[model samples]
Target: MDSGIEIKVMNPRRGDNLVHPVGVGHATSASSAPLSSTSSPLPDERGLRQQQQQEQGLRQGQQRQGLIDFKPLKKWVPWIVPGFVLANIVVFVITMFINDCPKNSVSCVAGFLGRFSFQPLKENPLLGPSSSTLETMGALEVSKVVHRHQAWRLISCIWLHAGVFHILANMLSLVFIGIGLEQEFGFVRIGLVYLIAGFGGSLMSSLFIQTGISVGASGALFGLLGSMLSELITNWTIYANKLAALLTLILIIVINLAMGILPHVDNFAHIGGFLSGFLLGFVFLIRPQFGYVSEKHVPPGYIAASRKPKHKPYQYVLWVISLILLIVGYTVGLVLLLRGVNLNDHCSWCHYMSCIPTSLWSCKSQQAYCESIQYGNQLNLTCISNGKSNIYTLSGERPSQAQQLCSNLCG
Candidate 1:
């Protein structure tokens, strides 16, 4: 009875189906026992864990691919700087043709290379235009601008140059300095700064240089330098090595200004341009990074929640002051220019502002002068007339006698 009860229980546990005969019970037990032992949960769990890990790795790779890569981005090219260069070259070519620039002549080439490529300053009354061609082309002239109300010269003269070397030097400097500024600030802002600064330089030149025909892009270039300083100061946080950059810029400005102390350089224009650019820099070139937390780390919801600018209070104060000064400067400059304020009348000694004082660099009311010429032991006086290339010779034994004769004839 005990053996029968055990067999009945084992048969039900093995298989309850009618298809299995009584003899097949041992076979079923043998096959099912091995299957149950081999099929453990550990292997299945390991496979599942591997699949999950692969999926997680794939998701991580996708996220990395979605991130922005700033390395491959191309740098912005500045067209305005090149445009200014081309325009300057074109104008220079036209001036050369107008001046009847000689071809393949040593003295002519040398003159163009040096200072005498154009006519003498005193030959043109009131240190008028460098040449008749320049005057016709609207070169800046104190008498013409003040007396005739050709206020346009203030803008036009910035494009004019005295000689080949002069234009070459200025255009090179423009390309060097302007490209960087335009690249950083975009063309529109840079363009505005350049034009306004140039105008400011011209206005200042008119005020201080009361007796000369001034031309060239030096003032505009100086303005660019000034703007660079203001840019550095305003965006101090953004630049790497702030102190080094500031020191370098300051050094460049000082060196250039020192060059102005030399003869015939327009220092007033440099100062005006620099000052205008410095003031305008505070107004126009403020960077987005200034006085603000970087947007990359901020949450979208938090950024949207704060509608106010993240700028410091000092930044706002600077902006207001800069705008006010710029507006006032433009207003005052235009008013004074239109009113025909004769700076010469008000400041007779103002010519000294443009030139250094020395025995050789003395100011003259008339252009004519006497030059001593030596022919062996005998001395001769050459009387050079204003606006005329004709040389008159006064022959004499003594140098003093010859000088007296030249004074009588030339003066």
Candidate 2:
């Protein structure tokens, strides 16, 4: 038996569908057969198909694995921020009812102010409640807190506000800053920071403010600002434009603190809350991006080598420093508050300026006028001073009496 195969080649120039035999092969196997440029040289078609199928399956498997590994990031909603805002509004409403607040007028402002008044200068019987009414409520009065042991005022005062403008300013700040922080860190941490900061502010107020009833959430808002600063510092590496972010945050804090310099603003509360929040941020608000192992992952081993930290070494150092500072600060504040150390003894004007002496308003001048009139002495008078007319009359007296008295004195 003879085995042979014939090969054919076609010439394109002829343009005819014909093949001319080029060679005759003898005893040739499929494995040794010549392959065309377009044909693969594999001997077994099934094996080649199997290999191709395996490779295609591997690519498909890899794609499926990638899909399986992908996870959607968790979305956070700011329920706590809104909850706090609602609470503050509710408290303000309660205060309005208690103080018999008017709809809209200078009377309303005076009413709120009178309700929190601790001294004669602050009282206005025609406008609102007296200091007694505020004490009955939860106003943070130093005398009431220290002698009467009404320390709960420290917490309660944070929810109270003097008037519409006061609550509005505080709530606006809370919403703007608190919502973002609550979304990032969740409710528990933000709430904790807020409460602690508020308490810290209250403590400082009680320590220094000898007169007047202090209230409002300005201290807590300052805490949020401070926390933002610490957060920016700890997560500095992750931010694309850290310098810009830091400067903006610092500017906001500075502007807000500067406002405290204005008359009747509690600068101590602001300072204390900001300091507490700044320190607490390092302890509580640290993100996984700042280095520690993420809550999502578990370390295979307890050894240092097995636990990989993502944050730089300096971040950890800052964390430790912050914790220490917070501890020391709290300790000092507590000692001062508990020991009943009078801030006025050391710094007489620490709580308030001796005299702001504004051309528009002067508490000292008002106090002088009140003092000039003897207690229980009736007076009906009017005078022109500082390009404005002044008038005063006893509650039961008529305007005519004041005019007659003014004419008698001026004449």
Task: For candidate 2, write residues 124-199 as lDDT tens digits.
Answer: 3222333334555698887777777777888998988765567788899899999888888889999989998898
Where in model 1 is the C-alpha error above 4 Å? 1-75, 101-130, 290-310, 342-353, 358-411
lDDT of 1 by residue, 202-262 (tens): 9988776766578888888998999999878877766789998999999999999877866
Q: Which ten residues in a row have the lowest lDDT in candidate 2?
A: 365-374
State how far residue 113 of model 2 sits from its true place (Å).
18
Candidate lDDT scores, in order, read: 0.67, 0.65
After TM-score superposition, the amount by which residue 17's alpha carbon in candidate 2 deviates from its true location, in angstroms, is 25
> Which residue runs does candidate 2 get wrong by more than 4 Å?
1-73, 101-132, 290-307, 310-312, 347-411
The deviation in Å at residue 232 for candidate 2 is 0.9
